[model samples]
Target: MGQNSSQGARMTSSVRVIVVGAGCRGEIYSQFASIHPERVQVVGVADPRKFARTKLQQKHKILDENIFEDWHNIVEREKFADAVLICTPDRLHKEPAVAFAKKGYHILLEKPMATTAEDCTAIVEACTQSGVILSVGHVLRYDPVTHKITELIDAGVVGDVMHIQHLEPVGFYHFAHSFVRGSWRNEAESSFALLAKSCHDIDLIHHWAGPRRCVKVSSFGSVSHFGKENKPTGAGNRCLDCSIEGDCPYSASKIYLNRVKQGHTGWPVSVICPSSLPDIESVTEALRTGPYGRCVYECDNDVCSNQGELSCDGHEVHVFDFLTQRSTKHKAHNDAPRNFGMSGHGGADYHLMAAFISAVANNDPSHIRSGPEETLLSHLLVFEAERSRLESRVVYCGDAGRR
Candidate 1:
């Protein structure tokens, strides 16, 4: 945190950036430029939604000529910025990443790199060929806790690093919001639950494993909680019309409206309704019509809410768990006000951006922890783990790249 900020300010000129996909991730990364005006500046933005892109356009004072409704438009035109932040949806990553890398723009692509191993490889290859810094958005690597863990292992405090067990509690309401009714509900639409929600865990495991490559991988998971068979007998398709909605733990109204009552109109609330200061009526209307209101048990979501994967290098074992269950109560949002600023992902988002800016400003790739090759390796592990889950067999990581 300390060095990343000072390193960012060392540049002669702020690194001009183009933000593609002005959605939640897009907005989070774009805010970095606003905080450090001398380090980075948002010069262009591309998004299909007027409501989304307009926010960045106004906040960053981006010129009309630089605003684009499609990323293809940005690719066609001459590259205007030194770097591009590819925060597009999961399926849309490879094309934009490859194109932008070919265009010679240093890229900060969001996690999971791409849906397929081949696509991920292509992005890495493109960045390698173009000789531009390619930083995948593995924000967890920059977390203060993660750095401490790395230091302990490095300093021999944790002697002879062997097996590591990790758990990613995706949380009940959060799972319903993101993996059930939200953008990442289905694997085909986005990715499997492991890749979509818990890739961070996988990457972190890889980081701790260090040079000991995962030789054998096997995984298991299913949509046990949110399937149609689990829905209440008298439940309505939407929470608004449901008779037993209030008693349900995954109720949309209970989730979003309660947040509004707590004066939290950002995130899970803003995702459903576009209004800045959405009242109860607007949020209710959004739940009534939008996909967010759909009953968690009735949505088209097929990804597993509980997933487990085991990877080992023969001697040491690593266990991964992605558990999302019905909770009795949701945690209070103590940091809601600062949420609009840099406090996302335990403040790792800000650190990741700061490191990226430092790398771009100084033309030094070493500042990036999750660079192309390492990211591709971790993504391959995720893909292989999924294959092992579906196939019910062990998958050798060495065979992952060939496949």
Candidate 2:
């Protein structure tokens, strides 16, 4: 309620922005502008989904003319905005971001920045050339607890972080929802599992690794557990028709109905059902045909459910999962980053957005802790890790922090 109340509040913003993609990430990050009217203004919004785009429209009181169906239209018609919040999918980020950067708009892009190494470089070059502040979303570094950890390490409180045992146990159901059945299901479609999911931990590991650059990297994981062989003998292709779905932990009914039990249908549910559909019927039909409703063990998903033995800086972390569900257990002692007069006054993710808005407001890059260059190191680590996995040999990631 505290964060929601902060979001609902109205204030004036020096940094007015057009939301380029009205998906989950776009709305969550850019809504700060909607919430804190003083720090940021949601001037325009663009998304392929009309309902999603219109939702942002109603919230911000934006004109019908300002709501666009795609980034292409916004760039063609709208001459300028103070900043562009590019929250499109992994594949779509580079173009809208580079376009707006050239248009003299500061950018707050979502994570992985761009899927490809080349695309990432293009984004960095665009911002550098355009002289617009570019802050890729690396929110873990902005979290207060993470901030405290950063402080502790800097102050020698944690006996010198010689080795880190990080794990992103992205929760079984969540992994199925986002990575298995959802947008990031395969390497060819969006990105490898590592970049799409665990870039946060990779980035965090790099942040903690600090000056200790990786000399060698190797990774090995596959779709061993969640494959056709693992599918139960009596299970149908979809959850709706599947007889054994009740026993399955990753069943769609178990996932979405529980949300219904909680008196809300956000995220995983919203993803399965269209934004406009009633939860029960929508989810039912989705199970009948949609990708999300497919049996977790039966989907065409190829990303690794688990990978480990991340050897970095002479330290061997035997297991590190995507998005860090288990690493959270370590947070009781090890805290995250702290805030110092953040611009929009939100949490780590929100605060990072705030810092970007504040940086735009103050015209100071120092306001943001991680910019394009810092983000690149983490992305490079992911690339090298993937390379190591594919080539089956140690890839030398010389000077990971030296970009």
Candidate 3:
């Protein structure tokens, strides 16, 4: 990796950064910051979970005073830093982002921007008002593979970008862990599958096709497999206590119990909560009463595990999350479908961050290559698709003015 010489070759001269949400994405940001100490220094971290904050502090050697539970408090108490990384859940991005932006801090916002378009618009307004460098974390735009594809398409290797197709086969294990068994299990909490998991796809479609207003869209989906209706008769109250754990494909005991045995420590255990009576009683109690502990088959989760359809611009995308399946992949097509292969953040978040960082350092929006205006079109497409899915008809994405 090339070093950022402009920031000086000393860790002390690097941009002082703080990360909100010490979860998976936050951890990744911290690790990246740690590795490039000369370019970025993680000065603070915030998460409600004590374990998450403690682990991040220990991992990155952040001072105890800088480990906070609430990011708002951090922004309130501390002077403006060079940059802030908002790695919180989709729903929680707006507040901290708006807060830090007003403080004249450059922002690295996580994707989906917010749970709703209105919230997203508000965030954009806040950033614009503050004149802070704001970059959304739609990282797929930065992937070498994806960048190559974009180049080929621009070069007319893929003529006219006619009716692009994409697939997010959210590998079964990933689907189970995130959509079925993790923080994103409920639509109320996460908005919907499209926004929560597939916003990157929406963003990508906008990026490739130019600003053709999404004319029509439709979506169809069903929970299909994971729910109380599908649970076996006489199934135990919890996966760990279940008698037929071996027979069931979504056996928490088999997946998480074995995972814990293999030394896979971190949020997954707290997220999945395999044991009815967990080794850590506090975590078990938290799961029992909180959204995380509910049996995947017994939660209030209504988002479809399998969703697919076409957008008005003739672009087609399919998202099949076999919460019960095992592998994941993303495929895109110009003339025919070409496998782009699997990625760490669905190939979106990482790519988005790299581009945003480069843009900030370069002081150029053209280098951003993607922006809210373009990403918002994809958001509209998804909205239209959801509408069509419910109404059972094609919906067109009309020229809704930039939000």
In order, the Cα lDDT scores of the candidates are 0.83, 0.75, 0.65
| Candidate 3 local lDDT, 1-403, one digit each (tens) | 2232122222334567788987767766556555456666788889888877787788778888887889878877857467788989888888898899888888887777888777787888888898877777776665545655566667654457679787777666567778887777788877788877787777777778764656556787878878888878767756655677668766665555555566654545644433332345545454445544445687677788887433322233223335545442334422211222122443334445545555555555555655656655566666667777778777655655333
Candidate 2 residues lying further than 4 Å off, grouped into runs, are: 1-13, 275-278, 308-346, 399-403
Worst 10-residue lDDT window, candidate 3:
334-343
- TM-score per prediction, in order, is 0.89, 0.85, 0.79
Worst 10 residues of 1 by lDDT: 328-337
lDDT tens digits, residue span 1-403, model 1: 2344334545778899999989889999888887778889999999998888888899999999999999899989987899999999999999999999999999999987999999999999999999999999998777655665665566555466788888776678888899999989988889998888778889988988878888888888888889889889999999999999989999998999998889887778878876444779899999999999999888999898788443322122222222433322212112112443524766668778888989998898888989998989889989999999999888777754446
Report the lDDT tens digits of candidate 2 across residue range 129-183: 9999999888777765566566667765455678978876677788889888988
List pairs with backbone clashes in candidate 1.
Answer: none
lDDT of 1: 0.83
